[model samples]
Target: MPFAQIYMIEGRTEEQKRAVIEKVTAALVEAVGAPKETVRVWIQDVPNTNWGIAGVTAKDLGR
Candidate 1:
């Protein structure tokens, strides 16, 4: 089995997230020869306030 974990700010629509998962799974299947059914993609969304970059939070940076 192949597993992928992606972290990003919480703002994308459901369709976009689904597309990401599908694309990531396909990539893993092609690159690592993992079975399509055994590929797992997990997306973890964090609030802007909880994500920081440089000296400020993502919300403060207008992300």
Candidate 2:
């Protein structure tokens, strides 16, 4: 089974989230030869305060 967990800030349209899952599953199916049923992806949404970059929070980075 090719399983993946992706973490990102919450705020994407359902379409965008679906696209991510589809692309990841497709790659796993093609490159790793995993079956469509065996390929899985889980997206974990975190708050902006919990995500940071350059020692700054995502909210701060946006400022």
Candidate 3:
């Protein structure tokens, strides 16, 4: 089995979430030789306030 873990700021649309899973599964099937059914994807969503980059939070990106 192949496993993928994706972490990102929260507030993604349901379609976006589904796309993530589908793409990861396809990659695992093609690259890792894992069956689509055996590919496992785990998504961890963090709040904007909890995610920071270069001393700026995701919420700060809009500014």
Candidate 4:
């Protein structure tokens, strides 16, 4: 089995997240020869307030 964990700031639409999962699964299947059904992808969305960029929070940085 191949597993991928992705972290990004919150606010992506459902469609965008879906695409990420699908594309990531395909990449893993092609790169590691994992079966499509055995590929696992997890997306962790961090709130802007909780995510930091340089010395500022993502929210403050307008991310």
Candidate 5:
């Protein structure tokens, strides 16, 4: 089994997230020859307040 954890800012639509999941799953399947059913992907959507860049929060950066 192959597991992937993806972290991103928390503002994408459901469709977008679905697309990401599908693409990531496909990548894992192709790259490592993992079975489609055995590939696990977890998307972690972090709030802007909890995400930081260059010593500033994403919220503070208006991201």
Candidate 6:
């Protein structure tokens, strides 16, 4: 089994998130030789206010 956890600042469309999940699953299947059915992927959408970059919040950076 292969598990993937992805963290990113919130605000992406549902389509984009779906793409992320699909692509991640495919990548894991290819890289680790895991069966597609055994792959797990989850996305964590962090608020811009809670995500920091370069000592500044993503919200403050206009992310």
Better of 4 and 5 by TM-score: 5
Per-model TM-score versus the true fold: 0.96, 0.93, 0.89, 0.95, 0.96, 0.96
Worst 10 residues of 3 by lDDT: 54-63
Model 1 agreement with the true structure over 1-63: per-residue lDDT tens digits: 998999999999999999999999999999999989999999999999999999899999999
Model 3 lDDT vs. the true structure? Answer: 0.88
- Which tens-of-lDDT digit does each residue in 1-63 have in candidate 5? 999999999999999999999999999999999999999999999999999899999999999
lDDT of 3 by residue, 1-63 (tens): 788999988898989999999998998898878878889999999899888889998788852
For residues 1-63, write the lDDT of model 4, one tens digit per residue.
888999999999999999999999999988988999999999999999999889799999899
What does candidate 1 score in Cα RMSD to the true structure? Answer: 0.6
| Candidate 3 wrong stretches, greater than 4 Å | none
lDDT of 5: 0.97
Ranking by TM-score: 6, 5, 1, 4, 2, 3
Give me the displacement of residue 20 in model 2, in angstroms: 0.3
| Winning model by lDDT | 5
Report, for every candidate in turn, its global Cα lDDT versus the true structure: 0.96, 0.90, 0.88, 0.95, 0.97, 0.95
Candidate 5 local Cα displacement, residue 40, angstroms? 0.5
Report how far off residue 60 is in candidate 1 (Å). 0.2
What's model 5's TM-score?
Answer: 0.96
Model 2 residue runs over 4 Å out of place are none
Model 5 ranges off by over 4 Å: none
In Å, residue 24's CA in model 4 sits off its true spot by 0.3
